[model samples]
Target: MPIDHLNPPTGAMADNVIGFARALRKAGLPIGPGAAIDALAALQLIEIGKRADVYATLEAIFVKRHEHALIFHQAFDLFFRAEEDWKQMLDSVPLPDDARRKPPPASRRVQEAMAQPLKGEEREAPQEQEIKLSVSDREVLQKKDFAQMSAAEIAEVTRAIATMRLPQAELRTRRTRPDRQGVRLDLRRTLRASLRTGGDIVDIRRLGLIDKPAPIVALLDISGSMSEYTRLFLHFLHAITDARKRVSVFLFGTRLTNVTRALRARDPDEALASCTASVEDWAGGTRISASLHNFNKLWGRRVLGQGAIVLLISDGLEREADSQLAFEMDRLHRSCRKLIWLNPLLRFDGFEPKAQGIKMMLPHVDEFRPVHNLTSIDGLIKALSAPTSGHHGPLIRPAA
Candidate 1:
């Protein structure tokens, strides 16, 4: 039956629909009230052949928050798609499969060569070969470490991260309204009562907008130890930035440089190239305490005004891991919403936070996680979607 034509609908129809939309939002689609209305309107356009049609509308309306896109994508497949029992059936399909000609291997098209046969059995000319631009196989290889990677693999990982979008990096905030159950004021209603207090003279008004912005700041280390990973981290920072306007990004090693401007460049290659030129201390010694002291004192007030989540990306093998490092690390921990330290060292199968530098930094971080591979980046998305658990990592540093 058509939903609109199904008689006087149940009194709770709107409530149930709202609840389902909220679940989709929690799963990662950026659905708000307007989109919910759009979803309901879509139901009218589609035939109510089954629940799948209803679900398809909801999924179509809410699947754009890139990070949660994958989850919603998976949920739509698993939830909306009809489940089927399977029995193994084997059959060999015939030669019609070869009807699809083989793609010319690396632009070595036999047809093109035939079209321009060799002159006097000598090669006519080395024609411009087309670069087949696709990323499936290359993306698979980046799940391994760079130190263990071949040169070609390294180049491929760079290109992939330059293009990957980080989903669920958007912040969530709470808002207050008078009709909300947890609202703090009844002033308008109370003022009506206060008219009786002053001989029926209404003498009061109370209303306010309550909001909490997700305070977030990042301190990325660009030390010699972090050279490889830091370059990749910049890509993540850039993706986060294009999604949100006010994110803060800083690069540190021997000194602190606010490369927010450098990162904002539209081209990832240009952005990283500009950042490299702007930084004087690239692949230099780590002076963690000094760089952070500058951040805590100079830029903290401007960026950390809101309860910002601080992301510290580094290997934590500080050149100077002294009382000063402890002091600065402690100061930084106290000034942010959540302090997450993403150590590439954590990628090792057998790792521990046992190094003196890591031991010092670890106790202060609210969470510790790896940030080296595509799988690790995906995990970061999930962690950002909800919250992190079992946050621990090994002490292994990247092999030189």
Candidate 2:
């Protein structure tokens, strides 16, 4: 049955509800006609004049996931509230003028949704305007910082990241395979083959070294300072995990939680949702030293074998910067083939290893690279593919 057929809402109220549903759909919510019907049905039980009741009714019908809450809230505010009040609220600028002028992360998509015309609704003709086609917006978005992006931009970036392919650099192993031009000859095989030719040696089998992708162990910080970058890095990890089997992921804030299984989900959204549910210390305090110590003691030997590469993604802002931190860092470095530190803080031009934790950890990392934007991520990919010329050694300060 059509949604309008049930309960038969007054013309104005029904139109508003349908338009609101359309707006939500535009804003990336998965609201369908059934949800709209349900919302209308729900409204019948509650007083529509009560704002809280209306908000609850619509939210209960529309939202299905935790991350969708923010988008739903923004959409509700813009759709149900008076148009002039919303315009005024959005227009009001806060102090520190420049800081207040920027829109909240979800506001951009909410505004876009509001501007979309509902079906069968009379719309004013758009004013004539010149259309200038230029470079694709995606090219521009690649360089944008993850922290500054809106919800829609994040969705776009997530899709782009899911399609990104990691460079496969094979590591030599002790295992060997048969090859005609191998360095070592297989005498047994050669002798057995000679028997087939009536004691005449026609060919010799040789064995060569086997190569495979080194395991990738990621230790990502989920502390307050590193929250923005961690989420995006998780998306990257999910993509790589789906592509490669030997990848392991760990999340650390006040403690360490191995999220390898959680990230193994094929859907990025589902993977992140699982990660969020499993991790308890997200956006909490930083305890780099303790987390590293835990990893070195419990997980290092397991995942750091067979020329594994460790990607340490953090800002190196430790709440407990002590000798143990350095010791753990050294042990971790020694266990892995390469210890690359990916710090979003390195995006700054004048960044230095001034923080106590950074100074302690810098001596152990093979490479120190930024990871705040897509371009920086691309740089990391290139760095991983290229050969490393040993560890860079301890940090050396320049003379003033």
Measured by TM-score, the strongest candidate is 2
Q: What is the C-alpha lDDT of each candidate?
A: 0.62, 0.77
Residue 257, model 2: Cα distance from true site in angstroms: 0.7
Give me the runs in candidate 1 sitting further than 4 Å from their true place: 1-139, 150-213, 387-400
Clashing pairs in 2: none
Among these predictions, the greatest lDDT belongs to 2
Locate the minimum summed-lDDT window of 10 residues in model 1. Answer: 82-91
Tens digits of lDDT, candidate 2, 282-323: 999999999998999899888988788899999999878999
Q: List the residue pairs that clash in candidate 1.
A: 67-167, 67-168, 195-200, 215-308, 215-309, 216-308, 351-394, 352-394, 352-395
Q: How many Å off is the CA of 223 in candidate 1?
A: 1.5
Q: After superposition, how far is residue 202 of candidate 2 from its true place, in Å?
A: 1.8
Provide the TM-score for each candidate, comma-separated: 0.55, 0.67
User: lDDT tens string, model 1, 220-268?
Assistant: 8888878888887777777767766677888898899998888887645
